[model samples]
Target: MSNSLEILQKYWNHDAFRTPQEEIIASVLAAKDTFGLMPTGGGKSITFQVPAMMMEGICLVISPLVALMKDQVENLQNKGIKAICLTGGISSDEIIDLLDNCEFGNYKFLYLSPERLQNDWILERIKNLPINLIAIDEAHCVSQWGNDFRPAYLKIVKLKEYFPKVPFLALTASATKRVQEDIVKLLQLDNPAVFTKSFARENLAYMVFNVEDKLHLMEQILKKNPQPSIIYVNNRKSCSETVTQLESLGFSATYYHGGLSPKDKENHMKLWMNEKVQTIVATNAFGMGIDKANVKTVIHLHIPPNLENYYQEAGRAGRNGEKAFAVLLTNPSDVIHVEAQFLSVLSDKAFLNLVYIKICNYFRIAYGEGIDEKFSFNINHFCTKYSLPILKVYNALQFLDRQGIINLSQEFTEKITLQFIIPSKEVIRYMSLNKQDEEVILTILRTSPGIYESQSVINISLIAKKSNTDENKVLAILHKLNEKGVIELHAKNNDATLTFNEVREDERTINRVAKYLEAQNKLKTDQLKSVLHYIKEEKKCKNKLLLSYFGEVINEDCGVCSYCISKNKTKTDTSTLSEKIIGLLKIQDLNSRDVVKLTKYSKDDVIFVLKNLLENDTIMVKPNNLYSLKN
Candidate 1:
């Protein structure tokens, strides 16, 4: 009864633990290093969460995302388990109270970002606290090879050095072979037991549509299956736009993104989870750490950053062992736009230096002095003070962070600059097109440094004021320069930041390291999109496509995916999976999750398969899924 199976049944009502879950959870309980490679919706959190509940001491979970931490903590609390999260967006006093509660309370779990580990004040108190185990979420980010690598998350591995007796568990939804090795090595796991569940989803179909009328297509698809759904878009603007369109068609939909205020975000999430909202349109920011089971469908308005991202996003649907749909709406032209958006973060050396200079001037902090200061930025104010094009300036600021020139925290500041190349005499060429054009150009230039000097990183907004011109007009001119190559344009490459072990090198060495990384990063970007292209191709089963691409071969096709559905477009499945039937189910009668495990399939493959099986009467689900051999 105390083993993994009983644990799954008593507190949680599942009949059996999946292939990797028992092994992974057992390793954690036995005080051994563990690595788990479960695809999304693989019940990954439960593997750690259940064992943590049984352990004597608190399971300190190190997570990279603050929002994800909060979500996990909230879920545990809802289950009537004890948990707390430490993060900066909340008050310091509240954190102190929470830690204090943990010190004496029955706190079974403590969720936090790795950045919290660097807080000396918190570390002093936490060092004495008895930690039974440690779990790292999104463990792949610990690796430089991972798509969204973070320097801070890498610190989780060093926790072993501190609490060497406690076991470590690293969990991730997706990671390439290289990324997996890096995660294990970086964490310094000692011959850790690796648990890899099959990465196939047999019931959910894989689909890629090349269409011009994405919105119209989305409407048609929604019509085909009216159920609880999610619509994923790439940007906040698109989230709002999609939600509006969905609502216009009488679908009760809501939108979620980073731009929404915290209260509004919470409200929107509650609505979605409660089934009050039939569809939720959102960006990649929406689904992390959200566990709304029974999501009937997931639609992507734009192609995702990579296959890992897309797989995870699509996996959100059909968590309840029911049939679900995942669709991607894309156009060929979208490739150019997505590529540009990604490459915007990777800037030339000169552009990076410009940003570092601007950041220093914006905060009025000298180099090496702005390590951890807090500032909230105003883009309009920044544009006016620097007279720089707001877009390029924004991109450059991001690049500075990428270059490790400055720490762009969850904070922002307002300052601006204008280059002096287009002198007043020559500025007349672009002027009079707008009333504030000439004055705006002069003002921005005055507040900021000249683009020609390359050393004068100035504030654009303040300069706009000095020259008595419009910030918008100033931004227009700066964009014009970037367009005209009047000055070098800067942009952000991807969502990745550096992950260093320590600051062993000095400033010069850091620059050398960054430049090397910059080059390697470019190579990674150049090859990443091709992986996504494979996912979109119509040639193979989605899961097989990924495995073959990664050099992992499967002998048989998982006859349940977008490709399979199209090939067998004659039938539709309606039977739902159940637990009782699953328990009575022996070899020939596998429910969705069982088939997934038995076949060693991915989420996409399994979903597609179950849908096909149900349609063909290849599998039958009675009440409680007592799937007696069906033919």
Candidate 2:
């Protein structure tokens, strides 16, 4: 085998790199600042991994998600690459020790979250490592112009300042042209070449299902695409509730979200990755850096916040190059729910000032001085007490953070409730009269909030396991009873998640701030419009559209998109895919480039045939960076 093929076989055990991968790898190895606009499952990690293995020094990869960092490090170690990450769960002393290992130890890849970049000891920790390349995953987060702008990303500029000779490789599955430019400018890359691969997935069908009952809908979708799948819900409550429903239906599944204990999240995720579990019902927080290539489908329990989010979540399916499907389940009310959320974000300056005051009053302390005291907040209760809009209040809090008022650490807590308010006999009579509804009635009573003085902290799992029902049923039945006005629903200490801009702007400042907020609101609305555009785009192949969104322009169609497939069905008549391969290669080599080179045939035809050949072991990509006939 030739050098590239030997490296491929030795480490990744693949026949050859995907299209554009060779060029990308070559650029990075040559010490050029490289930007890769590859689609989901396009081997973006491999581009950096190969170069990291080839280079003599360590490659520092800055990622936003800790779970993604952990998974990638484990996967690399599994492949015999030395890798590690310094995340928050560890102590500072442990961090010092880990840094010791990295500095003198035989480690090639070191991953760190951008937040850690600002840590006082981090620069001290890595002041002397033989670092070579700096790979920034989720590069869009660096740009304020993108959907998830993280201020921590700005700290990455320190990399170039600290180590001027190190090359940079920024990789992201989804980004807009503006975000790509921002990443390049932010990272201070000196004239980087963006290698973009097509985003079209012919094997993964894009479809949506409208369902009133999400639990029933989840089971139906799971049964259809039974292979390992991911089900994304908007909240942690929904994630756990859906997992319970899936488990009740006898599908072994798990759940993950920012809400779960880190240990629980880690254990449950391992089960799915290890194939001990077949499904994971989770919030959008799950599934980054997940490289399980055989995921069959991804079901969105509700509409995603934006097309960028939806596309990234959906793209998780069919990664093994096999046929897969991605479906979205939407209810009409979902739009209203989302709109309500967005509108609530428009809290007036008074609400912000009021909440800021309450926050200060609650702490009996002002901002910049509460580092030692822990805060637990329920926006609903807080707003109710203050007669403020919860959504607007929430936005005020975020804006305050933007204004440098408070520190909102990433922490979540569970809420529990008691079921009925009536006496036992009265409840018995109600159940007796509605004998057919006993199970449903019992569910409402048991899962009902307020057992502790008619209210308990959130403990749906304990209730469900005891009552032999799932959280979804518990919630659904409770809603049914509440609809009939049988009992009231009261929650307490809701959603402990909090963020603080370092200082609260006083109420006296609102009239002066109104004009500025109006402009910010318009900017936010425009961002939402861009999100809608990503969703409604149907003209270009999905892959090409996604790549171009990241500012990488592929001159030819991917030939492997769903649109290409449907078109090929109507236009071409062939007995075998080999004939199609020959037709494609007649115009060019059978490399990933040749597959991408054709402007004539549908990309769906080219990719579908390529997959078939790979599966049957008919055609093989060999050494010397070329494809050839094999028997």
Kindly report which residue stretches of model 1 are placed more than 4 angstroms away from their true locations once superposed. 1-19, 89-101, 104-106, 119-124, 383-520, 535-538, 549-551, 559-631
Question: Model 1 Cα displacement at 312 (Å)?
Answer: 0.5
Question: lDDT for each of the candidates?
Answer: 0.67, 0.68
**What are the per-residue Cα lDDT tens digits for candidate 1 across 1-631?**
2766766676678898766888888888888999999988777888888888776878888876767777788877887888998864455688788888888997989888777777678777777677998889889877776766666665566577679888889998888888889988999988999988766676676677654457766887888878789999876656756776778888888888765556778899889888898888988778777777788789988877677787789989888778777887765456546677666655566655555555456757654454445555565565555555656566555444433333344222222233345455455566655454566555545454335443243444565567666556656666776676444444221121222222322345346546545754564585557655664566677668866544467876667666765665654232233232333355455445455456554434445544455556756655544345474
lDDT of 2 by residue, 10-91 (tens): 9888988888888988888788999998877677778887877877889888887666788889888998888989865456
Q: Give the root-mean-square deviation of each candidate in angstroms.
A: 15.8, 15.1
Predicted model with the maximum lDDT: 2
lDDT of 1: 0.67
